[model samples]
Target: MEGIVGYGAYIPRNRIKVEEIAKVWGADAPSYKRGLMLEEKSVPSPDQDTITMSVEAAKNALKRCLINPKDIGAVYIGSESHPYAVKPSGTVLAEALGATPEVHTADFEFACKAGTEGMYVALNLVKTGDIKYGLAVGADTSQGAPGDALEYSAAAGAAAFIFGRENIIANALESYSYMTDTPDFWRREYQYYPQHGGRFTGDPAYFKHVMGAAKGIMDKAGMKPSDFNYVTFHQPNGKFPFRVGKMLGFEKKQIEAGWLVNKLGNTYSGSSPLGLTAILDVSKPGDMILIVSYGSGAGSDAFIFEVTKRIEKVRDLAPKTRDLLDNNRRYLEYGEYAKFRQKIKKAS
Candidate 1:
């Protein structure tokens, strides 16, 4: 059967507390905690970018699978913040991963959901026998306006999944999607930060698309929210995903199982995939997992998966999101954060 054979994740080694950001801007606590629900956010170093993070994630995934790079037939990289505008990040990743010249590689972008979108595409390719193994990666180092609310929450991470027909750990059962031409949030070509419609984004864009897709998949599979052992959503912040969970009748236990945003902030394209890696780390053999990913322009992709017995053997090879957060970190002040994010350059 065609399914996910392995998974991996990468979180940077730096963190900035939301309270620190609030102090820097002289903003009240309510805005940072209540509005964003983020206490700390991960910050990548100057040496790391989307491509580097993706490579690390992909490496971990390959290690777990023990598959030769030559066996990977295609590589797909999903990111809105790719290091280079003209070159294909996937191709660069393929080279870094030591995948042979025969592989097909490309990059994808669809706001934040691009990585999930790449997962869907990779699954289809593997199912059709177009590839024996495929890699799908989601990574980003998102930017927000200096001193803006988004600055405190925007972060970086990467997750990679290797899909194949052998040793399947989670089989894809059903999938559903919802799309709309809503401009809930967006950054123009020349813009550094995104423009959002605020309340409109919450009500019609995120809620509508995520709910529509989740419900659609559940309905198609003849299952209810309680049937799944875990549910992970694309976390733009800590609040939005939890709100959607409540609306969809998912319990706190289910939502908390993937509480990535609380500790790591929003990794943009990497958010949902990183959550999936966490789920796989603690999930049992027979557990059912439901995942939803959302992007601006607004769209959502929902997927249903069932864990296999093989998971117990491979689980240890994958990095737990908690460990990734707790063990690896370098604290940064507001000034350092600005320099890492390139808001300021030193005098020549």
Candidate 2:
């Protein structure tokens, strides 16, 4: 069966707290904190972007599986914040990983769900025998207007998963997707920041698609919430994943391992994938997991996986998600954050 052979994630070490941001915008940090359930967000350095983060994450994945980069037949990167408007991020990434020249590569975008989109396609290609192994990555250096609600959660990170039929750590059980033309969020061709429908991003968008995909996948697999040992949903904030889990009949204990938006902010495309990496780090053999990701155009991709004995052998080969998240953090003040994010334009 085609499934995850290796997985890794990269989170920026720089962070800016909600209170720090709130202080600049004259917004109430307590209210913002309570309303969104966010504490801080990771910020990319001037040298970091979608491509750079993807390469780092992919290298980590390689370390886990010890797979030859040249043997990888395909590579895909999903992100909205691709560094160039006309160039493919995959070429740079493939070359960096030494998977170039002979490998097929492409970039993908579907908002926050782009990461899963890449994963889905890569897994299917491997399943079809079109390729021996496929690499899919979801990464974003998300953008938010200086004082918009998104400024609190738009963050940076990347997650990469290598799909192959051998030595699998997580066996794919089933996969599903739900989509629609809902206009909950958009960023025009020349726009620097994205616009969202405020409260509208909820009912008709995130929750609806996420719930639909989750339930549809469970029904297709003939399983229920109780059948899975762990579940992770796209976390736009600290509250959404928990709220959605409750609505779907999952307990907090099952969802907590992957609910990192509170401290990490929303990594958009990396959100759910990174959560899955976190869950896999602690999962035992035979454990089942469900991951559902939402992108705000809007739609969701859902997958079910059963852990294998190989997971324990490779989990320590690379940095764990929590270790990258919690250790040696460099906090940034609002002004420094602004400079790094380019919120304040420098004279060119």
Candidate 3:
């Protein structure tokens, strides 16, 4: 069976508090902090972008696995923040891991769900005997328009999953997806920041696709929400996930471990995938995990996994998501954030 053998995530140390952003816009900080349940959001340094972050995350995942880099036959990177508009981040990632010259590589984008899309494909390829192992990554150094609501929540992070048939950690049981021509959020070519449908993004877009996909996967696997030990959904904010979980008959405890949006903001494509990584870090043998990811185009990918005893052997090989979130954080003022994000463009 196809299963996750190794996984890792990278969250940048620099951060911007909601108050710092709200102060610049002359908006109420208490409202955003309480409403979105966000205090501070991660930010990438001037030296870090999607490619560099992806490489770090990939290296961490590789460290947890017992295999040669040359054995990974496929490399897929899913992100909305690729450094180049026309280049493949996958090649750069594969080359960095020394997995090239004999691997299939590609870049993926589906708003926030792109990472799970890559994982879905890699798992299938391994199940089909196409490769010994595959690396799938979801990451973003997201952009938010100045003075817009997104400015408070769009954040930077990455998660990489390595799947193989050997020394399985979490055994994949089933998968499903739901999609439509929803236009709740989008970014046009040459646009620096994305546009959203405001309140329209809630009921009709994010919630619908997420719940639909989650239900579809449970039905396909002949399991109920109560059968899972943990559940995680695409977290646009800290609130959406819990609301969705309750609607789908999952309890607060089921989703709490993976509900990291409050601390990290929405990492776009890395959101739910990173949540799964968090669950894996502490999941016990035989525990079941259900994950559903939503992207803005928009669509959702639902997956069911049952943890294996092998998980205990490697869960500590790399850093846990919580440690990174709690470690040394360099706070940034609005001006410093603008400088780091390149929001203040200098004339050539």
Question: For residues 236-346, could you state the per-residue lDDT of candidate 1 as single tens digits?
Answer: 889888889999999889978777998899898999888999988889998999999998898998888899999998878767667998895789999888889998857
State the lDDT of candidate 2 residue by residue for 116-173, as single tens digits: 9999999999999999899999999998899899999999999999999999999999
RMSD of each: 1.3, 0.6, 0.7
In candidate 1, stretches whose alpha carbon ends up further than 4 angstroms from where it belongs are 345-348
| TM-score of every prediction relative to native | 0.97, 0.99, 0.99
Candidate order (TM-score)? 2, 3, 1
Lowest summed lDDT window (length 10), candidate 3: 58-67
For residue 312, model 1's alpha carbon misses the true position, in angstroms, by 0.9
Q: Estimate, for each residue in 1-348, the C-alpha lDDT of model 3 and write its tens digit.
A: 889999999999998999999999999999998888899899999999888888988888988886899999999999999899998999989999999899999899999999999999999899999999999999999998999989999999999999999989999999788999899999999998999999999999999999899989988888999899999999888889999999999999999989888879999988998899899988999999999999987899999999999889998899999888879999999999999999998999
Mark the 10 consecutive residues where model 1 has the least summed lDDT. Answer: 29-38
Against the true structure, candidate 2 reaches a TM-score of 0.99
Worst 10 residues of 2 by lDDT: 338-347
Task: Give lDDT per model, in order.
Answer: 0.89, 0.95, 0.92
Error of 2 at 28 (Å): 0.7
